[model samples]
Target: MKKKRSIISLCLSALFSLMLLFTSFVKPVNAAPTITLEQTFTATANPDVVGKWSEVERLRVNDTNITQELFITDNEHKTSTIVKGFGNDASPNSQLFLLHKFAGWNTATKPYPVLFVHGAGSDGDFAVDPERNGTTPGLAQSLAADGYAVFAITFAHPHGDNYIQREVLAAAIQRIKDITGKTKVDLIAHSKGNMSSRMYVSDVKKSWGTAFRNDVRRYIQLGAPNGGIDYTFRNTWAAWGIMATGAFGPVPYTYMTIYGWPTDTAYHSIYSAADGGGAYPGQAQMLARWDNVYDLDIFEQDWYTTYYGGWGYYSYSEGIDYAINQGGNLINTLKNTPVKSTVQLATLAGSENVINGVVMEDDGPSDGVVFIASATMTDPMISGGATLLEKKVLPINHVQLAYDPTALTWIKTQLSR
Candidate 1:
C-alpha cells in the first residue's frame, strides 16, 4: 500500500510541473500603463480640456504621432527685426518692439492665444520672468507648455505715457492677430500694463480701426491699479523707501525692454529735453484729464504751490482735494457707463504689509504700492463695459503680485474658463 501511495504522489508532482511549464511558454499579455494627468495649477491637468474658451476641438496629447516643434519667429521690418525669445533690443525704430513667441503651441486644442502686458515701469518678461534671476520657468513658458500660443510684449516705454503705451499696445495686438491668424486674443496684464490694456480695450476699435475690440475675449488683470495707486502720493515715506531701494530701476529697464531707459534719471533727462526742457518724468507735469486710469490728482491740483525757502513744500493734500473735485466727470463716467459684455473682465488684487513691513491704514490692506480697493476694478467703464467675472484678493506685495504662484494659478483657472 505504501509503494502504491508513493507512485501516486510522484505522478501528481510531475503533472503539476508539466502544467506550470505549459503556462509559462503560452505567455501573458501586459496591460498599458494608466495615463496620469498632471495639474498645471490646483487640480490635475486634463488632456481633454473641452468646454473651455477654446474654439477648436479638444486635443488628446498622446494620440498624435507627429512630434511638435517649438518655433521662434524673427520677422524683419524695414527698420528693425521682430524676433522671438528674450534679451533682444536692437530695434531700429524705438516704437517697433519684438515679442517672445513660444513654439510647440497646440492651436488645435487651445485656440485662443494669450498676450501678456506688464505693468508700470515693467515689460512682457516681467510676467514670464518676474524674478529676473532666471532660475525658474516664467508663467508664459508654463502656459505655452499647456498648449496655448503664448506671446509677451515689452513696451518701448512701460512708464512713458498712457497714450503712447496705448498706441504701441494696439500695434502689438494687431501684430498678434496677424501672426496667430485669430480674430481675437486674450489679454493678461499686470500693474501699469493694465492701464494700457484698459485704454486699448476702451479705444482699440476707434484707434486701430479693426474689429480688435471684438477680437478680445478675456481681459485678465493682475495687480491692476484701475483707480490709481494712492500710495504714490499718500505715503511719502514708504514711497521714498521703495524709491531708494531702486524698486523701479535698471533691472526692469534692461530685462524685457527694447527702448527702455537704463535709469530713471536717464529717462527723465530725455523726457525733459523732449518736453521743451520743463521737468523730469517723475515731476513731469501731467495734463488735467479726469480719467479713471491716470493719477488725475497730479494734474488737477498745484502740488508745488507751497514751496517756501526754508519751510520746504507741502501741498499734496490740497492737491488731492482739488483733484477729487475735478474728477467728478471721471466719477460720473465710471458710474453711468452701460454694461457692454463683449469681453470678459477679471481682476486680481493683493494686500498685506507695505515695503517697510508695517501696516499703515487698516482701511482694507495694500500690496505695498497699490491698495486692494484700487487694484480691483470698481469703475463703471470696466465693471460695466466688460462682463465682470472674477475679483480675487491675494496676500502679497505689489512687485511680487505678478510672480505669486496662487495668483498664477488663479490666472490659469480664469483662462481655462
Candidate 2:
C-alpha cells in the first residue's frame, strides 16, 4: 500500500510539473501594445492585381543542378552574376550558388548600393527559375554592371520571420557590410528578408547605439507583414505570436514593423520607419506600392490565448503545444509555411529551366519560401534607418522591387532627391 501511494504521488507531481511548464510558455494576448487607428485607412490595391501577379510552378531538371562558370568579359553593366555559396541542404549531397551585382560602380553621385533580400525558400540564385515573374536578373545585374553595387542575399536555411533565422540574417548582414567598405548601405529587402533586415539594423543600433543607424542610408521593405499572418495551419504560430508582440522575446531582436490588425499586439506599437503603408508625417513619402496574395485573415479565428488567461484570440491549442512542448526542435513556422492556395499558380507559371535549355518546372509559390503577405509593405519611410526624406513604393515583389526596371525608375527618382 505504501509503495503504491508513493508511486501515485510521484505521478501526480510529474503531471503537475508538465502542466506548469506548458502554462509558462503560453501565447500572448491579441490586444495591441499601442494603436493609432487610421479610420480612413483603406485598401489601395488595384483590381488588375490579378493580371500583374504571376503564378509559380514546380522545379524541373535545371532546378537542382549545380554549376560554376567564369565570365568572359568585364561587362561592368551586368545585371546578375551567380556562383556557389556556403550552406547545407536536405538532399544527401547538394550544393548551392550565390548571386551578386555591383551597382553604381563608377558613378560619383551613385545612390548607396541596395542589397536585395529575396523571399523565403530561395537564396539569391536566380540561375534556376524565377518563382515570381518580377525577379529581374537582367536589370539587377545591369544595375551592378552599370555602376550601382547590388547583392541578392540568401540564408543557408529558411527564415521568413522565424526567430533563429533572423539571428543568422543579422550576422549575415554584418558580414556583408564588413566585406564591402561602402560606409552607408541602402537596403531593399523582400518578404521575410525585410523583417530580417530590419531586425539586423535595429540590432546594430541597440548593440552599438544609434551610431550605426547612420551606416544605413535608406531602408525599404517590400511585401512586409506588419501584422500577424495566417497562423491557421502551423502548430508553432501561438508561441511565436506571443514572443513577437513584445520588444524581442522569441526573436530576441528589434522588430521594425507596424501591425495591420487591431488584434495583433504589434499593431499597438509602431516601431518601423513607416506605419500601415503610407508616408510618415515627418519625412520620406511618395513610395510606390505592391501587393501579396492573401491578407492576415486565415489565422483570424480566436483561440485560448494563454497569456490572456482564457479562450481568446491568441490562445495556444493542443496542436501548437504538442509541437513545442517540453522543449521541441523549435520549428520556424514563418518560413516553412506550405504554399498557400491563393498565390500558388502565380509563383510558377513562367520560369524556364537553365540546364538542358528547356522550360523548367513550375516553382509553385515563393521568391523561394516565405509567403506573399509577409513580403508586402503598404507604408512610407520615416527617420530610423537613416535619412529624413520622402518615401515611395514600387509595384514589384520584394526582390524585384530592388532591381526591376519599373522599380529602378522609382529608385532613380528617389536618388534625384
Model 1: how far residue 210 lies from native, Å: 7.0
- Best by lDDT, which number? 1
Runs with alpha carbons beyond 4 Å of true place in candidate 1: 1-94, 106-108, 204-212, 238-340, 354-364, 382-385
lDDT of candidate 2 at residue 25, scale 0 to 100: 98
Against the hidden true structure, what lDDT does model 2 obtain? Answer: 0.33
What does candidate 2's lDDT look like per residue over 1-417, in tens digits? 999999999999999999999989995432211111111111133212111112111111121222221111121112221111231122111112222333333342455655666644444543122433454354345455446656554443332223333343333344445556566666665544554555444432122221223355555554444222222222124234533443211210122222433243322211121322111110011011111333222343332332112234433222223212211222232222322111100011101112222111112222322233333322221222233333343334344544556655655454334
**Per-residue error at 116 for model 1, in Å?**
0.3
Error of 2 at 173 (Å): 4.3
Worst 10 residues of 1 by lDDT: 249-258
Backbone clashes for every candidate come to 6, 72
* Model 2: lowest-lDDT 10 consecutive positions: 278-287
> Every model's Cα RMSD, please?
24.9, 22.0
In model 2, which runs have C-alpha deviations exceeding 4 angstroms?
Answer: 1-84, 87-111, 126-139, 160-179, 204-213, 231-404
